[model samples]
Target: MITELALRRPDDWHLHLRDGAMLQGVLPETARHFARAIIMPNLVPPVVTGADAAAYRGRILAALPAGMTFEPLMTLYLTEGTDPADLRAAAASGLVKAVKLYPAGATTNSHSGVRDFDKVRGVLDTMAEIGLPLCVHGEVTDPAVDIFDREAVFIDRVLDPIRRATPGLRVVMEHITTSQGADYVRSADRDLAATITTHHLIINRNHLLVGGIRPHYYCLPVAKREEHRLALRAAATSGDPRFFLGTDSAPHVDPLKECACGCAGCFTATNTMSLLAHVFEQENALDQLESFTSLNGPAYYRLPMNEARIRLVKGDAPVSFPDKIQTGAGPVTVFDPGFPVFWQVAQD
Candidate 1:
């Protein structure tokens, strides 16, 4: 068995570092392992304009622990009234890397999201023309559609139509949770790709519902059946450039997660690297780990791969990680893969 592995530092193509106290507490966890991350813009008010993105970026930078090197790749939340000119300026200024599309009521803090796709046509056209990628929460909010079937349905009803209409528009189907999503990205052209989260690779819907409701395992675009989890594992470990790591390590306080109305998100930033090492090893695709975690995301986003390196070592005993991360807000439960992880990132 391979005992030690080293690779170029990875970047998280999708991440949610919530504002204020939450941001300060969680930012370091991601920064410690990832050289950069595409910061999600779905805060309560949302980051809708270049100015909002810039201000958020400032806050992220300010919150970063001293001496830690990390880049927050800003994005704009696409709304019905999104200013195309402001997007152009954001792109030209090189401050914003992409625009995020959240169908209204699709996920947390998404009430301000776009309700009418037709209303955002001009914005989509401008994005295509300017080569700005559109990162999407690939699910529909229709009450008729079963929650488990939303992603597959969204592809057929929404994403396909949008792609067909707007040629050359780069799109990332974020946190894709089904074979439909994986196969679609594989069959699509270079302009399309998908982000497979760390937790999705290990957990299925059963992990969330079986025995009891595992709120920590619950996340938006919720984990699907076992077959879907297998598909994600294959895509991530197949050396397919269309798939990459995007640890959507969203953190919610324990009180919120354990309540009657729990929030949808999994806090995995603290142990993602360790989990990825175990998953890749089990797939016997350990050789392809770097491409999925480090190389592919940068290639897709048109950013350079990180120069720094990280080393993972397989130990004799199960690797130990914190069960929860304590913040001023409260205790945030860390995602437990429900399997022992024997690999850990080597300390400097």
Candidate 2:
């Protein structure tokens, strides 16, 4: 077996590094693996403007361990009344990389998201004009819709019209779950891409319910049936430059996750690269691993690939699923998959 696969270093196209102590606690894991990560903007109030994004970036910088050269590519949270002027200013600053669209009630702390698609038409047009890509959460929030069907439904109701309404607009369907999502992104004319998460590529909806109500397996745009899981695996391992890595490594505390109203996220930031390598190996596509993990993402973003490198060595490596990770507020148990993972990350 190949001990290592070397290519351009990887960038996490989508990531959620939650703020404060949790940020500090988990930042190292992602930094250790990726050269740059497109940081999600879904904080309590959200990073709605250039200034907010800049300030949030500062906090991320401060929390980073000294001499670690990881970069956090910032993004703005698109709101109903979001100022297009601020979006332009943010893009002009060159710090803000993209704008995240979270339809109202779509996911965590997203109650403040856009209520109606029509409301953001002006904003979408402005984004296209300014050359800023709009990254969408891509799941509808309508309570009437079945949870599993939201993604396909959103593509028809929201994504399709949004693309038609604003030609030349760049859109990234973040953490796409269904084959419909893969098809939509693949069919778009240009500047349209989709990010497939490591968890989604490996596990199906059955994994969520098979053993039990696996809270750790639960994530927004939640895992679908095995057939969809198979499709995601094919796309990620197909060596297509359009499909790349975006470990939507969202983290929540044990209480929050285990509560009656558990938060929708999974804390996979720590073991993501290792988990990714495991999945790709299973697909027998180790040669194409670099494209999925590293090359494709930067190509889609029109950014330079990373010069730094990371190595994943295979063995009976161990990662403990701590009941709670230490945060400023007491302890927060991470959602572990409750089994021993086989891949181990090696020092650079």
Candidate 3:
């Protein structure tokens, strides 16, 4: 089936484009499909302040291939000592759209994340007052919590009370992977939403360890079981505006990923639309694809949808994992399903 529809151009509410060469190489792929992306602040040393976010935004803009009209929305990384006034200033300045809260050791470059929820209350209150969203990693750092239960545990112990305490605070549960997480977002009355990653909808934990520990599939808030995958698929294609697309296309070099200390991330920016189309097709929800992929995100962020359109043709088209995408450290071969994606991006 070949269909060309003028669906709203989407924005990635959460994305990671590493700094320097990797940023230059991988950014164009995202810009080509997404109108805007809330650039993650987990770079080395991390984007801890408004100045850092602004500078990082400048780098992303400079790295874009000259004529592409994509905007990189900036975020501040919430650390143990992140100042309340600075956060308010950043939100007021409109340079920082959201503040990312990463529980210490929860994910990549997140060692500097907030160690305790209470420690950052001042900053959180400030964000709530100023109307900036809190983009969360949404996983607990407790080693005893069982790897698969981190998201659920975090929700029970931290997120729920935080939501109650800070009424009207906007929150995004980034790359959610559990039924509990999904239900929580779905039930929220305030400004709460979730970003579903393409990988989580298509793969599970077994997919990561099936053929041996697959580093490429090893992302933080790691892919869950088959049941959760089904839940994610349902949420993404259910035409629910609370659920939208955010590739979370984090990239890590080969050595970094395939080592004893394998880095946690997935580089799916290149194949995001293809994978999303594949999921929607499986669900027989092609009609709703535009809303999940393109419309919901911009609406939640209060940004205008892109007027430009992208045409995707449905048919067998090979989407292979590159042996490596050259990064500063080395090459990185992302984990791919190793098959032809029936939908291919033809125009944008």
Best by lDDT: 1
lDDT of 2 by residue, 1-348 (tens): 776666566788899888988899878778877789999999988999899999999999999999787899999999988998888888988988999999988899888899877888888998889778889999888899999999999999988888888998988889999999888877876878889987887778888888578777778989999889988998899997888889888878767777677777777767777777777888898888889988988887878877877777776556554455676644555545545666666666
Q: Model 3, stretches more than 4 Å misplaced?
A: 1-5, 316-323, 327-329
> For every model shown, what is its TM-score relative to the native structure?
0.99, 0.94, 0.95
Candidate 3 per-residue C-alpha lDDT over 125-205 given as tens digits, one digit per residue, 9 for 90 to 100 = 888887788999998888899989999999999998998888878899999998888899889875999999988988899
lDDT of 1 by residue, 149-228 (tens): 99999999999999999999999999999999999999986799999999999999998999999888889999899999
Error of 1 at 317 (Å): 1.2
Candidate order by lDDT, highest to lowest?
1, 3, 2
Tell me each candidate's RMSD, in Å, in order.
0.7, 1.8, 1.7
Instruction: After the best TM-score superposition of candidate 3, give how far the Cα of residue 213 lies from its true spot, in angstroms.
Output: 1.5
Model 2 weakest lDDT span, ten residues long = 329-338
Model 1 segments more than 4 A misplaced? none
| Model 1 lowest lDDT segment of ten | 323-332
